[model samples]
Target chain A: MPPRIQIISILICVFLVAYVFELVRRRHLSEEYSMGWLVTGTSMLILSVSDRALELVSELVGATLFTSTLFFFGLLFLMVICLHFSIRISALTKQVRTLTQHVGILDHEKRNLEKKMHQAPWQTSDSSLEQI
Target chain B: MVTPEDDRAESVSYPEPLPQAPKTLIIIPAYNEGKNIGAVLDGIQKHFPEIPILVINDGSSDNTETIAQQHNAEVISLPCNSGYGVALQTGFLYAVKNNYSLVVQMDSDGQHDPANIAVLLEEAQKDDCDVVIGSRFIGKAHYKTSFARHAGMLLFGTIASIICRQKVTDPTSGFQVLKSRAIELIASDEYPPDYPDADFIILMNRNGFKIKEVSVTMHASPDKESMHHGHKTVYYVFKMFLSIFVTLLRKSPKR
Candidate 1:
């Protein structure tokens, strides 16, 4: 790679890596949570570097490396966001199931308590108390 | 037909005996606590041997499972480190499927006193509470947590209470006794991840389960280095708050 292209590649990699690190630091991305963003960031940087090597061919196609890189990154981000949403959906489903099960148990317990209350002799009207 | 003893018992209140429901299950979720879980299990076994203990080894690369198994605890090993929420919900699922009447969640870090486990059970059984959280800040005990973490917890608890429309003193307290229903409710597929205590508590309240908090002493963990500090702590706080906000926006399920 030429010195200028190499510098550009290095800068691109640095910017993307730093941005992802910032996401993690800001709690936008969790370190142990998932590998989606890291993969996306690294892959996008590689694509940017390769596209620069093909700059002459790309100029024939009237596309700049910067624009193409941004476009690819946008797609990568969308994919990661979609993955996150799916994970959230699954987690939410588990929460709903657990919540319903708890409700059912509570209902069952309430009914049992009600039955006991009705069956208790103390719950009945006492003629002996009236006599006293 | 009322003898002196029968009259005394009846005078106390209702005469019907509440059949001893299924035994309460104690769930200790531990990660890399090889040094603590064995002792914790022994302490619990010595004190409450009647109650079964189940340890959810949350993908510990250490000897967490071996320690738990050696200590006679029923072990449920997760294949990977799925965070505390997954480990806890797994315990709840186990409780529900096994027909346990109540479930107690205690950390395996040895910070939580095993003797205090009975207080949680008592609150659940006597008050008929759907959930009883062992609050470290509620009573006279000295809270040794960092100021930032303390403020974070208070804020989280207050917000959780408002969202759930119920009083929640220690929404993030891992030490809790949950009625079978409460356990089953949070074992749902949509259970919030990372610091799920608040969201799960709110979920119980939304489902009409009673929630209560009891003050308990909290001792510092012997392994201070085990704490997740710096950027990780920031991430935990950020994710926890975000999860709560997102959870609040979710529409409640129709009865």
Candidate 2:
């Protein structure tokens, strides 16, 4: 890798790791999900700091440039994360539909109970007696 | 051969205890059908005076809930616009909770004749039938539909018939009667949300549930837009085929 590229990547990796840590600390992200980001950031940091590691990984990835290997892995990680989000969204949609169905049915039941309370004379008299 | 106990045992088989009378609940899923809901409710109420009616208002922007309430039908209003399948599933869930033996689902567009409810229910009463679909194309009923819709229905119906080994004349019919098993199925995790048409029938058949069809009279809708208009037709076909294929790939219910 070029000298300038090495210095910039190291800085970016440091920033990414620190940001992920901050998010987890502030409760914006849970530790379980943050593990993926933290792992990516650490791996990038190690590659930027050690040229030997990058060269070996690039050979395995069959990339002419070591930086291309990093880009390829980063793209792959993003695709996997997007697919995970899609699955989570589908589950949430089903949950919302079920809850909406329950809400409608429960509302109907509540209205029926209220109607019965108003129609029954004894209940009305008992409420009036309590008020007195 | 001379033993009296052996003779008695060979001659007679004990019968299971009898089931109580089957109770029916009518579920109508309506979305902005305030214009036509009144007459549909009235027609059904006139025909079946004692049966309970439930109108699922799918977050209609119009006065559908008020109209259904005025007609003395139980109205449940979703907080937001869930699709047609969700509304019907809501009714099924309600039925399962309330101990209803059967549920008849109908459209609020008034296309389905209320008098046809009897034919569907009678078919569902059979021991082998779990679902009774009221088809407009069966028998000599001459109901007219748009060319595109008719073609789509024919294609899907043919596919369903081939897969299920029975003639399915109308795969997109919104009218049907579901027995207790079918009602519990729609409420369970087995069902998918939205567009419970041919795919649902295929799923149920694969799960060992019997599907029967009855000929019924149908009239063209007065106002609602056709499902096969333009862009929607493309999406409907693609999503429908994909779900059908996926349903085939999934592990079927153990009979």
Candidate 3:
């Protein structure tokens, strides 16, 4: 890779790491989810700074071109991020369903209580007296 | 046409009546069926005047709740539009909590004929089964359904019947009668949150619940289209197959 391109990639990686850290500090992104991005950003920074490491990675990955190795890692990172999102979404769907069931049951109970209150005005007074 | 009075008379004289008619509650899960709910409730009231009806208004953006209330049917409005399974499960939970011995669940779209509630209840008692399903495919009732839906039903019916070790003709039928035991099981967390069709039948069977099928007449909604319309038919088939396969992998739930 050209020195200018390497310098630019290093800068972008640094920016990514800094941004993710800032997001974590502000409690916008949780540390649990940001760990993957942090690792990816750090690895990209290391690969951009070290030409020998980049060359070894390209050879190890059997990529004819260094840029192809970079592209492959980028795609792999995106796929990992997507997989993480899918796992989170699955958990969230289960949670939402459970919450909805609770809401439905609670709503039904509330309606029944209100109906009871309407049917017998003295019951409310009895409850108030008991509370006092 | 069978008059409401005739239907009531027939139900009263049905063979093998219980020592006392079980305290039955009809659970109607309504989703944006304001236009049709009134007629459905009226039909139920006309035929089964003694039985109380509870309508779970599943966050419809229409006057479903109001219409049900107007017809003197108890309305339990879910805060948001949950799926069909959630709505039905809510009713089951209510039934279990209120100590209803027999709970009959039917759709509010008028597809499930209220007149057949007697048939389902009788079958539940006669067969000594926990659940009685009203199957459309069994009877001579000319229920007009789309070809794609019928094909999908056939596929699911075969898979469910094999897993359940019994012939399940209409696994997707909403008209069902559940005894207290079955209601307790369904009210638990084991019930599917989405389409609880054939997979639910298999789950019930695995959980030691006896399920029997009774033939009943069902009609399509006048204005509403089938749930398996167009591209949805393909997605429905795929999702149902996957759900059934997953259900097969799950262990038998504890009683």
lDDT of each: 0.70, 0.85, 0.83
lDDT of 1: 0.70
Q: Name the regions of candidate 1 deviating beyond 4 angstroms.
A: A1-132, B1-19, B225-231
Query: Chain A TM-score of model 3 versus the true structure?
Result: 0.88
**Higher-lDDT candidate of 1 and 3:** 3
Per-model DockQ against the true two-chain complex: 0.03, 0.70, 0.64
| Maximum-lDDT candidate | 2
True lDDT of residue B135, candidate 1: 88
DockQ of 1: 0.03
Highest-DockQ candidate: 2
Better of 1 and 3 by DockQ: 3
When summed lDDT is taken over every stretch of 10 residues in candidate 3 chain A, the lowest stretch is: A121-130
Candidate 2 B-chain TM-score = 0.89
Quality class of the docking in candidate 3, CAPRI style: medium
